[model samples]
Target: MRDVSLLAGVSRMTVTRVFIRPDHVLPETRERVQRAVLELGYVPDRAAGSLATQRSGFVGLVLPTLSNGNFAAMVEGLTEALRTAGYELLIGYTSYSVAEEERQVHTVLSRRPEALVLAASAHSATMRRQVAQACIPVVEVAELPDDPIGHVIGFSNYAIGRAAGDFLAGLGHKRIAAIGASSDGERRDLRGEARLHGFTDALLAAKLPADMVRMEGDIPFSFTEGARIMARLLDEAAPPDAVFAVSDLAAVGVLMECRRRNIDVPHDMSLLGFGDFEIGQQMVPALSTIAVDFDDLGRRTGELVAELLQHDDPSGIARTDVGFTLIPRGTTRASVP
Candidate 1:
């Protein structure tokens, strides 16, 4: 900053103003400073600037993984919103482990972000306590919590699950199975567990035997994993009448496996998936799944962070619930004898 200011015939304060309040500087002066910065390859030290302003102007974002398109879309929404609001985002990835989340929380907090946003549902009590102690605004995305640490912007995965289960039961799917991720890293597991409960409860309400339902492996959520699990189920002597994959990617895999085996979707078998990703509707036999407004979720998160920062609230705020919808497509139908 000093070198760039010197080369531009300006003071260090001018450089600081360029970053924090560029609107205050004249167009020619701003251009000269930027050119000097580029030529000198000088970078401003965020840590020092944050200390001077007593605010980081940086929001910390932590998520399970970016490999999922849904998550990627959420991130895109968040970064764009934050950038437009004159803030930068600092990101961290927690592989969906409680312990890892705890560690990442500490790491992000150490940076003194203006606010923090988490993708997965908070699990560990210790981790929650740490977030509470941070004294900064926190936003948990994707799934809402019964008890939020700070502000929450998400929907009810349980409700989504129940909706899917009831839909399938209404379609007369007596023999159903579920495939879900076992990892605690994702809050979507809560959705899976709730879906399983809803699926079983709905079947029982219809006088179907609990034993008629089958559930498979507790692995990471992925399309390939969904495909492999569906293949195994298809190999069984009495295959399930329908299958529900916790994620759209998993559903895609199931569809692919069924296609390879020459099985007719919604005819020989029925399939249901969650997360109405673009691919879900684009696939051959469009997936019958739940659609989550992830973009809205991200926008709400950004708004919450901005609100908290602007207000500088110490008492924190209440959790916010977004909502979900079920998208019924060609993948599910009445079981054929």
Candidate 2:
């Protein structure tokens, strides 16, 4: 900053004003200071500024996986919204592990972020304690929480599952099968488990036979695993006329397996999935699935963080349900007239 001021023929205060309150500086002076900064490749000391302002000017964001496009879209929305508020995101990945999430929370809190955004509601005991102790605004995204630490922005995974199940059942399909994560040690797979439960509830509500609803798959949710599960289900003595996967990737995997086996979709079996990922729409037979507005959820979470930051109130509007939608496409059709 001193060098920039010297180069721009201005005092250090002018340089500071250029960066902090550019509107207060003359346009030409601002341009000259900016040019000097660019020529010298000088970076402002955000840490020092934060010490004086007591504002880290950063929000920590924790994500489960970067492999999922839904999470990516949510990050995009949050990034844009936070950027608009002059705040940056410090990202952390938990890899679907509760213990790892606790570690990540500790690491992010060490950075002194003004706020934090988490991907899911489920958190380790240590993580919850650390977040509560931080005294920073926290936003939980993707899944709605029964008890939110701060603000929650997302839809109910079980309701999404119920909606998908109802849609398939309403299409006249009686024989239904579901594939999801078989394990939930740390409730990491809570989203998938909830969906499965909701789907079974819908099946029972419809008075479908016990034999008509088959819960298959004992592996984690993944494309290849979904394909393998679908293949194994097809080989069973009694195959389902329709299949619902807990994720869009798994649904696509099921479709891929059906294609390889020379099985006709909708004609022979109707398929549905959760998380209406983009690839599902571009498939030869468009996928039918439950869609959540991930970007909107992110935006709302960001907005909530902004509000909390400005107000410093934890009790203000603790939750926001972004909701979900059921989209039917070529992969599913009416099983009977």
Candidate 2 has its poorest 10 consecutive residues by lDDT at 210-219
RMSD of 1: 2.9
User: Model 1 clash pairs?
Assistant: 96-185
| TM-score of predicted structure 1 | 0.88
Task: Write model 2 residue lDDT over 1-337, tens digit each, in one string.
Answer: 7899999999999998876667899999999999999999999999998786787889999887777888899988898888887789999887777787888889999999999998775777788889999988888887777877767788888887788778878889877888887654653666787888888888888877435333454434778878988888899888888999998888999999999999999799899998888888988799988888888888878887887887855555577788888888999885555
Put down candidate 1 lDDT per residue, 4-100, tens digits, no spaces: 8889999989988998889999999999999998998887787888888887888998887667777787887888788877888888876666677
Question: lDDT of candidate 2 vs native?
Answer: 0.83
State candidate 2's TM-score. 0.92
In every candidate, how many clashes are there?
1, 0
lDDT score, candidate 1, position 93:
75
